[model samples]
Target: GQHAELDVMRKVEGVAISPRDTVLVDQGMMTGRAGIFAGGDVIGGLMTMTAATGHGKKAARAIDVWLSGGHYEGHEKSPPVDFDMLNLPLFLDAGRSQMSALPPEARSGFVEVVAGISDREARYEADRCLSCGNCFECDNCFAACPEQAVVKLGKGRKYTVDLDLCTGCAVCYDQCPCHAIEMVADVAALSAEAHRPLRFKARP
Candidate 1:
């Protein structure tokens, strides 16, 4: 038996080969089979449990979007937001609040060990939630725009640019995390369907 190798994947390998195994995937997990999604060790990227778990969630969302007459282009990654990106003057290193802990005697029981923070501490933590490569409606654009071209739509709505008023100054784009906004030919008139800036330009 030393000469023989265990081929557990033998049954499935070379069975559903499409676009020659390595070139068919549209995003990564998608195979040639319609409505079928894949992940885990079978997909062969990271091949780790954590990567597979992430793929599972990604594939689930992809399937949902495909069923709903749309496509999920995968999670849009942004530049890492570090301390240098933030206004350092605003952060005084006041230190983080401690979470309420349960004593050893209380831990002896089956009850939850960690207790919740106070209302004030909770609010303080909530306030610290930064926009950070994602828009949280900080209203910085509204306040910074001298031309008033950028309009805040408030809760449950998105910001809009009045092209008639907008001078393409890029102040709004510059203010609200350039990592979040892509500078296109026309800042306000970019294609809604454009999924991030494609590194390889599309051919005619």
Candidate 2:
């Protein structure tokens, strides 16, 4: 009975009556009927924080459009700010916080699975992040290079290594505190690769 109706219901839209007495609403958006929107777990699917936030934003925009006699675009027109430029302090390290698990005996039955870290412990963990100099550009090589070859392209421009006058001296690589800059070989000429072997055989 389950397999018979499930096969039929899969093809149908809106409402479907199955032999197993299961009621399926395939498209919830159509069921709202009033043209007002509704969504989330009640409609049935994976519900996450990100999805909920997005749905809320969509609903608010729709309401705004309806209230304005449908003339409004119902979308935020402001350009989003680049998060890298925001310079907000990261509250935690790049790694996930270690959660204290319930004991095996306790875990067998229903019990709170994870314990929270204390305020002091959380703060100590947050402090461990190596801020890695200024948010994007580390000024170490910029400060150290005597040739002054390294140029700040601006906030929009990622680092552009000027090979024309770079000389392949590797002074920039040496001075970088965060080890971001690497001394890559100049590939402009075939002669540059003469000594730098293309590939090496593994040891026998």
Candidate 3:
């Protein structure tokens, strides 16, 4: 059995104590009081270090918004990327980069045993991410298109297909490894609705 001592917190007015003996807060982690907020173990639920860290980050952002007289409007929630959505063939089989560590013979008391990886190694390891359902500009669709309808919009600007040049062959859709491209059928009208911008956010 565990208990949270709310003796000091009880002095604060407008705060509500839940039936479970935890602090009742809103979506922004704010309690009944206008400026007061609660998070971490005091708020209950999964009491883990990772959860506490996430709470701290969220609370900090909320506090910043409150200070600026603005409501904390978080980013639009998106569905989690599952393993099945990943295009495994597009990425090469590269092993994870391991941190440099001192040998057992060289180990000493109080001395750091593990060392941070080099910038190059860090970049290499980060690049290994699957980036599931998102396009990383692999240029597969551009190369696969028979009509050369795929227009290259350099760097961060994603590609767009020229509808006039496109023949509805669906070659670009098939070649897209990350499932970012989707096929929409409308033979009667091949207007703007037929095309979708290839933005950073992938289609669910």
Candidate 4:
């Protein structure tokens, strides 16, 4: 029955089959060679609504391009609309809804099933994030450095240790409230791990 169905379908006009069927189908449909491209569970191995929509959109854009002699440059320069400004109620403090899972026995056969959070719940969870203080280097060590050897990197004011003036006094390490600074040996020798014992030699 399946062979007969295949033979009947193959006999349809404008059908072209090749050994590299996947590549040929994709190129033909996506490039607008046939004016339209479509396939489902039978023609394409993976059958999903998401994949079908993506293929359809690609084919539509290709057709538009061909009809316009490829002259249209779609959406060249428009500043991105700030999504935050959308201020949808979806962004407000509503928590997500819990989903119920299907039992193992009930989900034995092929079926489309999904568990997703409600919009309200998703927004409430997002509101819990702490957008707190400056993202770059913390200000604790910068404020505490007695020698003023640390340099402010930028407008956000992240600090970096200046090697030229640093005396390796370890004062910055001790004073930093946030513990952002640590004193290590100078740049000459880079060690992956700190040497356990300082190799001290008397200078003549």
Candidate 3 C-alpha lDDT tens digits along 76-120: 544665777655676689998889899999998988999989999
What's the CA error at residue 168 for candidate 3, in Å?
Answer: 3.8
Better of 1 and 3 by TM-score: 3
User: Cα lDDT of all candidates, in order?
Assistant: 0.58, 0.48, 0.76, 0.47
lDDT of 3 at 88: 68
By TM-score, the best candidate is 3
User: If scored against the real structure, what TM-score would every candidate get?
Assistant: 0.47, 0.33, 0.53, 0.30
Scanning candidate 2 in windows of ten residues, the lowest lDDT window is 195-204
Write the number of the candidate with greater TM-score, choosing between 1 and 2.
1
Instruction: Please report the TM-score between candidate 1 and the true structure.
Output: 0.47
How much RMSD separates candidate 3 from the native structure? 7.2
lDDT of each residue in 50-71, candidate 4, tens digit only: 6767666656765687577663
Q: Output the number of the lDDT-best candidate.
A: 3
TM-score ranking from best to worst?
3, 1, 2, 4
Output the TM-score of candidate 2.
0.33
Weakest ten-residue segment in model 3 by summed lDDT: 195-204
Worst lDDT window (10 residues) for model 4?
A: 195-204
Ranking by lDDT: 3, 1, 2, 4
Instruction: Give the poorly placed runs of model 1, Cα more than 4 Å off.
Output: 1-64, 70-76, 90-94, 102-123, 173-204
